[model samples]
Target: MRSRRDDVDDAAAVERALRLGLVGMGEATDERAERRLDRFIAAPDGAFVWTRDGDGAAYVGRITGPWRRDEDGAAVDLVNVRDCDWVTEPVDPGLIPAAVAQTFARGGRNFQQTHPGDVEAQTQTLWLRLAS
Candidate 1:
């Protein structure tokens, strides 16, 4: 099994592939894209979302500040979106890439995040990164 670190890397690669695919398909162009990349790179925080193990109910949560490492040397993944007063909705995991692209195009910061469902191609979280 791959470590969580590897999983994160894989997710990032997949996201990059998706973005590039979008651009190749002409959905993304250079005309107004520089601002989007700049916006994403400048963000200090990112939104969080996740799904439960049994039922694939998707939920959106507030930004949990910046990325950090725990004392155990493990990277802190994300806050429990399930624990907060988050918004729940039904979403198809396959559609995440497009959503993320849309977010970036609108000058929102976000990156690919790993989830149990994503590994299984079931459901995944779309972390919408935004400037604090």
Candidate 2:
């Protein structure tokens, strides 16, 4: 969702823009959106991120830069972005953990943190294998 504020440098501005209904054609925003934006803005460099494309291609990457507003991304409805050093190849579907697969399958346009026990362990294992 595009924020009305050009300078969305912190979570508070993002929260305000969202609450005022000034983002993305007056789309409804909620606590989840606020939390997601907060995490996106606050995530440290080197944090891992997983995402799937519209074509169902999964990718794994590390955050290499800070978040910023990319006006160029407006056409794609992805104005807020972070630079990532994604693995060159898409991850094999069979290799993805069950929790990760479920996250993708749920199909919401919000960033979410995976559960902490099995999901985290499995993801770390997958990351090690991929990084090697």
Q: Highest lDDT, which number? A: 2
Query: Candidate 2, after superposition: displacement of residue 72 in Å?
Result: 0.8
Off by more than 4 A, model 2: 1-32
* True-structure RMSD, every candidate: 14.3, 9.4
What lDDT score is found at residue 46 in candidate 1? 32
Candidate 2, after superposition: displacement of residue 84 in Å? 0.7
Point out the worst 10-residue segment of candidate 2 by lDDT: 19-28
lDDT of 1: 0.30
Residues 1-132, model 2: lDDT tens digits: 323334442233223323322222111267766667777878777677776544567767666777666664444345566666665567899988888788778764556677655876776677788877
Clashing pairs in 2: none
- lDDT by residue for model 1 (48-102), tens: 4332212332333443343321222122222111112233343445544444334
